[model samples]
Target: MELILALAIGVLFSSGIWLILRPRSFQVITGFMLLSYAVNLFIFITGKIHINKAPLTLDGVPVDPTRYADPLPQGLVLTAIVIGFATTALYLVVLLGSRGLTGTDHVDGKERDHDE
Candidate 1:
């Protein structure tokens, strides 16, 4: 499970980097979003994967809370997700304004000639 998670993060990070290098403004925004998601996953995994472990004890049962996964990372990831969404929305607005002003979606505010 941990290996799979690691590979997933790597894939997301790689894809994000690739997209970031693209010439399109929208692709860059999407790359940022994907990078943020990768970071969130990393943060969440720092708390460790608890299989079949209950975070809260039931009926006053004696279970070590420390045995359960830490909740701090979970909270952090949740907050990051919200912030990422807001930033993505803002980025889209900026992208639209840029496209409108430049009449192009390229990051440099202009489209290149097909020959180039």
Candidate 2:
């Protein structure tokens, strides 16, 4: 499962980077979203993979690091996801305004001539 997650993260990161390098505003926004997802996945994985483990210890039980999943990373990822969503919405608004003013969705603010 870890291997699969690692591979998925790698693929997401690479694809995000590739899209970010493209010339379209929409694509760039999508890339940023993908990058955020990859980061969230990375943060989640750092908390360690434990199956059937509780996130908290029962009262009077000995505290064992191995018995409970770390909650910090999960909390952090949740916060990051919220922030990422807000940022993505902001970016979309900006993209729309840019497109309205410039009449093009390209990063350069101008459409590329096919002949060029």
Candidate 3:
């Protein structure tokens, strides 16, 4: 499971990077979203995977810290997700406005000359 997750993270991260290098504004926005997802997954994975375990210790008795999955990463990921969503929405609005004004989705706000 860990291996599969790692591969997925790698693919997402790489794909995001690849798209980020493109000349299209929409692709760049998508790349940012993918990159954010990859980072969130990585941060979550660092906490380790556990099931049927409590996130906090309720008893005063001594307990092993390792037994509980770290909650910090989960919280961080959640916050990041919210922020990413808002930013993506804002980007889309900006993209739409730019597209309307420039009549092109290219990063440079101009159409390519295909004759070359």
Candidate 4:
């Protein structure tokens, strides 16, 4: 499970970096989302995984460290997910607005022909 998480983190990081280098606003936005996902996954793995663990408390049950995972990371991930969604929506609006105003979507602005 640890190995799988590590591999997933690596893949996410690599893909995020690659997407970020693209010369497009949308790609950059996607890269940010991917990086956020990688961070969330990394944080989640830090708490360790347990089989058939219940997230809520149960009556007449002692606190079992081996059976229960930490809730802090899960809470953080939830917050991050909400924030990510808002940011993505904002970015999409900004992208559309910029394109509507400038008639281009290139990260560095519109390309010019040397002959012009």
Q: Model-by-model lDDT, in order?
A: 0.90, 0.94, 0.90, 0.82
**Model 3 agreement with the true structure over 49-116: per-residue lDDT tens digits:** 77776678778858888677788989999998999899999999998999999999998888788823
Q: 1 or 2: which has the higher lDDT?
A: 2
For model 4, what is the alpha-carbon lDDT of residue 32? Answer: 84
lDDT of 4 at 15: 97
State which candidate has the highest lDDT.
2
Give me candidate 2's TM-score against the actual structure.
Answer: 0.89
TM-scores of all predicted structures: 0.87, 0.89, 0.85, 0.86
TM-score of candidate 3 on Cα atoms, chains taken together: 0.85
Enumerate residue pairs that collide in model 3: none
Q: What is candidate 1's local distance difference test score? A: 0.90
Question: In candidate 4, what are the lDDT values of residues 1-116, reduced to their tens digit?
Answer: 78888999999999999999987888988898889899888877666776677666678998776677687778888898888889888988988888888888877667555524
Output the number of the TM-score-best candidate: 2
Off by over 4 Å in 2: 59-62, 113-116
Which stretches of candidate 4 lie above 4 Å from their native place?
112-116
lDDT measured at residue 103 in model 1 versus the true structure, 0 to 100? 97
- Candidate 3 yields a Cα-based lDDT of 0.90
Off by over 4 Å in 3: 58-64, 114-116
Colliding pairs, model 1 = none
Q: Go through the candidates in order and give the C-alpha RMSD of each one to the true structure.
A: 2.0, 1.7, 2.1, 2.5
Ranking by TM-score: 2, 1, 4, 3
Q: Model 2: per-residue lDDT, tens digit, 1-116?
A: 99999999999999999999999999999999999999999999899987888887799998988889998899999999999999999999999999999999998888888825
